[model samples]
Target: MNEELRHQAYAQLEADADRIVRLIKVQMDNLTMPQCPVYEEVLDTQMYGLSKEVNFAVRLGLVDAEDGRELLEKLEVEVSKVHDLYMQEEKLESKEI
Candidate 1:
């Protein structure tokens, strides 16, 4: 792939990651427990979409397979942090009630 296409693919990948992270944060903010089934469904769908994009980028020579995996890994780490925050909020709310 040309440099421009490669740059575009990388930008898309980063944008997708940011979008999902923002979605997760919004869901957490709006939901009481952050354990809604619908939220999980949406998250799963978003994650799958991101994976497909990464695969396409790899096939197009826009990004290496290992780098794509690393990008996904970073997203997972962000998700884990959000989950931990949700759990902490739940615990604090429970203590008040």
Candidate 2:
């Protein structure tokens, strides 16, 4: 693949990951609902969309299943770091009292 196209692929994969995260949050929140007809449809659509993007990305060599897993791991690590930073800030602010 051309270098520019490879970069494009990376950007696309990143966007897809962001979208998947949002959809998952929606799914989780909806699980607490008593009865939500739209929940299932929304989840199903998001899932199918994610699968399609993954398939395309894999076929194009932008990301394999292992690569996807690695990306998710990195995402988790980043989120954890942010959470820890927030907690530390809260602690420091509390100490200022």
Candidate 3:
């Protein structure tokens, strides 16, 4: 793939990661314990896939390390944000009980 195409794919993958994080947060907010285990497994799988894609893209010269790092950093930020939001929601829910 061309550089532009590779970048676009990276963006899509990042979005997918963010979306998965959001879904996990939603599941957590509702106190869904059984689903949390499944979500954790899925998150691990997706993270591995994303890491492989980053390596492949860099190796193929579709993207440089700096570019890949930036994308990964963005993903990290999104994941952190979602986790924080979920924790806050959980705290609020607990207070209501």
Q: Which candidate leads the pack in lDDT? A: 1
* Sliding window of 10 residues with minimal summed lDDT for model 1: 31-40
RMSD score of candidate 1 (Å): 1.4
Could you give candidate 1's per-residue lDDT for residues 1-97 as a string of tens digits?
Answer: 5888888888889999999999998888886355678888888899999999999999979998998999999998998899899889889999999
RMSD of each: 1.4, 7.6, 3.0
Q: In angstroms, what RMSD does candidate 2 have relative to the true structure?
A: 7.6
Q: Candidate 2, residues 30-78: lDDT per residue as tens digits?
A: 4523135665566457556656776777787766677666665665565
Q: How accurate is candidate 2 locally (lDDT)?
A: 0.61
- TM-score, cand. 1 vs. native: 0.90
Runs of candidate 1 exceeding 4 Å displacement:
none
Ranking by lDDT: 1, 3, 2
How many backbone clashes can be found in candidate 3? 0
User: TM-score for all predictions?
Assistant: 0.90, 0.48, 0.71
Q: Rank the candidates by TM-score, best first.
A: 1, 3, 2
Better of 1 and 2 by lDDT: 1
How far out, in Å, is residue 43 in model 3?
A: 1.5
Q: What is the lDDT of residue 7 in candidate 2?
A: 68
